[model samples]
Target: MTEIVFTPIGTVHSPFSDPRDMPIQPVGARGVRGTIELDPACAAGLQDLAGFSRIIVLYHFHRSNGYSLEVVPFLDKTPRGVFATRAPRRPNAIGISMLRLIAVDGATLTVEDVDILDGTPVLDIKPYVPAFDAYPDERAGWLTTTSGAARTMRSDDRFC
Candidate 1:
């Protein structure tokens, strides 16, 4: 397999300095505010992003050390396939979040409902178009059973 490489287009700035006690998912982090500082070289790409109310942010989990095929997720007690959980530790150490776009100024973006940690390297940003991104009737697998727990769950040392 060929190796893939990505350059950070920006960095996320949030109140979360430590993983512990932070919301495990965006649903749990609702109303949390943060900022994205896009590289000046990529500032031009922000041209029409303001028109969108939300965006999909792909980022690197820089602080995650290793991976496990199975993990006891924050939302459940039973060990589940890592792919089934949104745990930070993974083979790629990558994470994605859909955050509300509050405002766009030059190379900076003020966002809400942020679950990402501070200083996270952002790989890509795409507008969240409901028509193309929302799945109103899709099955959520195990998530359907434990999603309620996610709303009040917080990160711990388990995955760290």
Candidate 2:
């Protein structure tokens, strides 16, 4: 067996103190503002990061307590494998989102369209280049019909 660990490089500050009724995804959180208060020791890493218009944030799902092999995702009535849905309860409890970058001041990052919770620990940050990250023709699998629902769906206690 092997063990892996990660230390957060920063903490995300957002309006969401509670998970219930929050936007389920970035599309649903359009215009929502947030910031990352990065650890001062990592401030030097921000060099050249401001040039990116969008950044991919990788954070920990700190509030999620445990794992479930299957779950009834907030968007669907049928049960789905944990890996297929973006349910927070998982083996690793990691989360990722693409946020619109507004500015970078020292170790602080201003971002928008954030669906993450306040005080969430940010594990990593990466520039979001559409040429490498986007898949215009990707399949939606079980969410084919309900894909657009994310634009308005809110979070609930289903995964909690």
Best by TM-score: 2
Write out the backbone clash pairs for model 1.
Answer: none
- The predictions' CA RMSDs to the true structure, in order, are 0.8, 0.7
Candidate 1 Cα lDDT to native: 0.94
Model 2 residue-pair collision total: 0
TM for candidate 1 is 0.97
Q: Write the per-residue lDDT of candidate 1 for residues 1-160, one digit (tens) a residue.
A: 8899999999999999998999988888999999999999999999999999999999999999989999988888899999998889999999999999999999999999999999999999999999999997999988898888877888998876
Q: Give the C-alpha lDDT of model 2.
A: 0.94
- C-alpha RMSD of candidate 1: 0.8
What are the per-residue Cα lDDT tens digits for candidate 2 across 1-160? 5999899999999999999999999999999999999999999999999899999999999999989999988778999999998889999999999999999999999999999999999999999999999997999889888879999999988766
